[model samples]
Target: MAAVVRGMFALEPAQHRAESCQPGGRGDASGGETQPVESGEIPRCLLVGPKGSGKTALLFQYGLSLVRQGRRVTFISHETLHTMPLHVAGATKPDPLSLKQLQILYLNTQEALLKFLSSIHTQAPLPTQAPLPTAILVDDLDYYVSTAQTAESAPVVARLCAYLVDAAYFISNKLSEDKTSVAGRILCPVVATVAPPGDRTALQWYERFLTSVWEVKGVAGQPTMYQLSDASSAERAPLVVTYEIGGTLRVLDVQDLNEPMEGDD
Candidate 1:
């Protein structure tokens, strides 16, 4: 079965690529490691921003890249699922070329989302024979938490966050135990999108679980800027990226900003 799965999603022999950022700039490496290091160097990350800040789009870009590399990507979303490409819906049976490699799961309510994370945590090993690495993308986590904000259910959200952190550790530890696993692959990293908390107290709650946080800032119809800060260091300079519908995505670094503007003398 492992062989069959391998055949279905052939691993590229080329060196695994890491997320790139300009010198002194920080870019979120939620989908995979940022450097050519071990599989579990950085396992969990949170994307925080206001609405219309393009957080979902950033996550989609990461997931799409993983899928293109023939890796397994599981996307769990409370919203924006309908806007995703049709292929991300996945296939019933394995197809080498199909988006079966990308599994999309939708959870509308907070309870369902909690249950899903709990299941992953309790399960010793994921039910998959494939050697391909897996990455989990959680979109609109704020929406999930908001839905269960009643006084009685408030604790559930905190537990949910803890479970997510546990899940990432469980997956990372498993991959780390297997030294032969591909570097910069195999370990599961949890990347979630979160809106700025309405209550200041909630800030510490998230900081407790997430290893890194990338704050996204931008307005609709404008380039989005990402400022990343991890447990290791203070926040770094932002990286600007622009995406157009039906057009290519462009990234602007510090050097790019120094270039002449359209109307510059």
Candidate 2:
């Protein structure tokens, strides 16, 4: 059976990506919406920002590149997804070429992620050639996590993240074990594009639960954007040198060259 995956991001949570909370509250990596890990370095990332922050656009560009490289990629987004030529054909349902190109899942319902993952896992394989390396992309993640009223939904979301972390570990270490399994050796890194929490409540929650966090702060006067660096950093990490879909670019972390901040908000 082909590997199945629950999407990490969906469009429903776009509105509530950033929410404020009281000073003392329970949120962060350990107890909140997090992406934990099993071990080893996996190429998983979380792109966070509010609506119109260009998350979906960036994903489309990235997905296309992976397709060109012969990587089996999947994109999960809700907005203007039909615009992506590689995802769909003339009408609804993915075309054979599109399916073989990369598995792109666009959804209107937030809960559809589970169903989608199930479908991927259980689907019949193509007889043409070897299966491509899979890269799962989730476009918007904050909507469901923020609106989850009961413990039920929260766990569902968390469990999905845990699954991703597990999948990454399994893929990275697939051949390392004494008894290698055919399953683990074929997977690729799972990349998710999430809207980072803009306010106290969301930010705290993300820091606690997510294994990796990368921030994008709009540059003051410059046309290009940059990434925030940890306090110990000696220089700017690097500017976004590569361009992706809808003109999205890589993160540039240039703390060392930039002026010091009076205080962070």
Candidate 3:
């Protein structure tokens, strides 16, 4: 999922697999598992785009990529598409068995989503099994946050972000502190897709808690052409990724896209 646009956002979900190997790292004597708060876990990400700009497809691809690498992912959505076309960066077809590693949880309401997130924190301390998941992927976060009764209230958005951040921290630190990781330190990142609010003010409210942001915009003339912009960094201009969405996210050379970006929503 992250393999194609990863270059755009520089999201390396694979880092969680190698955190223990970092220099000067200390872990259990057997595996040198990364210690709590010691490993540099991948940052949680927010993929923002208008409808049909390929945000959900890209997310599914990213999670598939992580699963292919022997990592586990928990995908949550209030309304997952019944027929979402999915494939990894270079795969000819999405593997059927890989879906096992990608656990899909249908959280169908705003309250359900919040309660599920809160439950992750309150769950019994890190289990004595495999390490924590590599990533938590949420689709259509705007629906979850904006459909609440108090959607316009600041606390609505604030609490959601807080819950997500805490989950990332808990998955990263609590599991490692318990020395339950087989691959050293535990690293978990949360990635979610959101439809950009029509009002820029509302969009800004959501970004306040985002560690990374990638926006997908469509080409005006070419239906297959989409430009992905990495706005995660304020220090530099957002890097743009123009690509054609097929079975895979095939990158189109920058010189080929002569059309201006417009709406696909």
Candidate 4:
């Protein structure tokens, strides 16, 4: 949905807009050639950072935004979430009733997580009366990929990513198939996070599946302060959003003039 902005993935609004990744193309009437038309775009975002960079808080904020728009969210994690984020920086506080729309699921091991995704990919199971998720957030996807203790983890990890996009993203696309506007008046996005790996070489293997990459960087001169920026962009200086999560999540400042001014709320 055009209403989608930074809340989608804490990304630079201008770069990740729906118009940026429109799928398919249309005939160019003037040139009789196929040209890309503005259709619905699927935003596949990957959030990379180290432990305690507030990645979970950012993802929760994104899920809360979808809930407010009347969409359901499924947050999958390796362990049970101990706390729910409230009063996040640059985000609206979600009410009790609305928060119910955000469901949490825990799959504690890589094998278990992969199995769940594979099952859902084929069956697309849903709770008795609940609607399909408009957003699927995997907190620390690395837990389901990098921590595998075997040599065959690569293919399994790749499968996890596939089912995530196929099953999770398919939920949004199927809902938007007729509506044109994705379910919940927003693009059904798959937003996931991963702690930066010890060996940087492992990164390229994952980047192939991501459409956009946002990084959480600790502010050099400040403690308990961090910035989120799009590391996928190679063209221009990316927009940087500075935020804090000491007690309550609060945005202290932002940099980069190229970010869009409208639809930011």
Candidate 5:
């Protein structure tokens, strides 16, 4: 089963607690402080963009970052798996999963994805050992949505979104169990990428559930640009993120860009 599933499970001692304890990190708050404003709250972020807009790359990069931060990451992608061989061929040494800690799930259909989630929910408890913090990265959510739309047995978009949300919540609950348990102490955030909506209204469905939304635009001979804002805010200017060829993601605040440059003055 492991051979066919591409599973890698390595239990490593907690290395950096500070990295996991940060506000946006995997150790997000579990209880008390506040409802939605808790310091350690897990985030549900959605990234929307056209083809070749670097959405998949950004998702993978985020997964790599989480792995580096000593967090367990489950990177699920149907599209990425189609090109996995090429990616593995060109992969650099000490690759992202070389540590054997990340759980990479290649799901091609909605049923498969749901089944995986269901298994996680019902799986037997882990031994009394500290589990690494966890996060989920789903690449190309639009593909799944489209797949469901074309299927005869698929549910409506709203129902599909609810299923996904339930899966995410189930995973989070499993990870955020009693601290002494093996699955306890883990924070699980769900981050996914979707193709830009053909009809703007398509976005309304995702926005209803996602905590944050980011839009990526790519232009020939220019850096890929990203605009990030809260899901509820329609009027707020997006915080821009520029992706450069050398793998640098420069975040530029729109307010800062609006200020007159010293040379311009």
Candidate 6:
């Protein structure tokens, strides 16, 4: 049932669109009664890496896995990943959300993006029901930089950034106040794909925006992945691992790795 293939690095099935993933069924808020927690555990995760570092793939695979379990997942991709055929299709008919009359907004411009985010803050809830649990998956945070480049666009970009940070803060606060509320129940795992900046200002920009950063080095042939836990280490000795795919993506079973072997020709 676990569709995680070794070295595949894709999002879980549940995170993908509803057309392909349907495992845990659906979340019917109006069902009148709530179901008891069978697993007693919430499955949530966060992924951060560089561009083309398999971040999106991993996001999809893992998201799909959660979807198969009947979890409500929201995939927020930037201009690049959101435009991809698979992603666009998934957004059109996202796994459980589409069935639940939920909306998945894919913003291509800074203005539309800000408007969407602002609504989240202004929207109030009904008295009898709890706010819906929202699992947010944001992809390619680097886009924020590009969107901020234009002088006229900087305000919107800044607002969007503030919104994201605020969303995280709001969710954290909800989780603290009520253990079983939507804000509390929501699992937001963001995936950002960033590249090494061209200059000091850019580097500073990246450092200010990202809370955590990881590295994806080498190339398709001789690839290496590293999670830079220490800020200082990111510039010095970042964690690096090389991998190749043949069959499935089962991270736990990835063996036979000796050294940074020369890639195939």
Predicted candidate 1 versus true structure: per-residue lDDT over 9-110, tens digit per residue: 222211133322211012344565533323335455677777655566566655655566555677888754664432211212234564667777888887
Model 1: lDDT equals: 0.52
Encode model 2's per-residue lDDT on 45-77: one tens digit a residue.
555654554456455545544454345676766
Best candidate (score: TM-score): 3
Q: Any runs in candidate 3 off by more than 4 Å, and if so which?
A: 1-4, 7-34, 38-42, 125-132, 151-153, 236-238, 246-249, 254-265
Candidate 1 — worst ten consecutive residues by lDDT sum? Answer: 1-10
Q: Is candidate 2 or candidate 6 better by lDDT?
A: 2
Tens-digit lDDT track of model 3 for 1-265: 2323552322443334333432112234355445455333446678888776667777887777567656678888787668854443544345678888888889988788888778777665434543355578889888777688863645777788778777777766765566434545555667888887677677666667765677778889988778876665444233456778666566664421224566733
Ranking, lDDT, top scorer first: 3, 4, 5, 1, 2, 6
How do all models score by TM-score?
A: 0.61, 0.53, 0.76, 0.75, 0.66, 0.52
User: What local distance difference test score does each model get?
Assistant: 0.52, 0.42, 0.64, 0.63, 0.53, 0.41
Q: What is the per-residue lDDT of model 4 for residues 1-265, given as tens digits with 9 covering 90 to 100?
A: 2122266334434232333233211111244322221122555678888788778877787777667656688888888777775357545567889878998888888777767666654443345535666677899898877667767655755666777777655554445443333322234577788887665556655655655677788988887888877776434335677787677777777676655677885
Can you tell me which runs of candidate 2 are displaced by over 4 Å? 1-39, 80-100, 118-133, 147-157, 167-187, 198-201, 204-210, 221-265
lDDT for 264 (candidate 6)? 42
Which portions of model 5 show Cα errors greater than 4 Å? 1-41, 80-99, 127-133, 149-155, 181-185, 220-238, 245-265
Which pairs of residues clash in candidate 4, taking residues 3 or more apart in a chain or in different chains?
1-186, 89-249
Candidate that beats the other on TM-score, 2 or 6, i.e. the better one: 2
Model 5: how large is the Cα RMSD against the reference? 8.6
Which residue pairs clash within candidate 1? none
Evaluate candidate 4 by giving its C-alpha RMSD to the native, one decimal: 6.5
- Which stretches of model 6 miss by more than 4 angstroms? 1-51, 65-71, 79-104, 125-133, 149-159, 175-189, 219-241, 245-265
lDDT of 3 at 57: 72
Rank the models by TM-score, top first.
3, 4, 5, 1, 2, 6
- lDDT by residue for model 6 over 1-265, one digit each (tens)? 1122211133233244322212222223344543432221222222345655556655555455445445455556655443322331122234455435322446776566556655655444456743433445556555655766565433543455556555544543343244354322233333334455455454444444333444444344444332222232134222233433223222322222322557844
Clashes of 2: 17
The true-structure Cα RMSD of candidate 2 reads 13.6
Worst 10 residues of 5 by lDDT: 1-10
The alpha-carbon lDDT assigned to residue 38 of candidate 2 equals 36
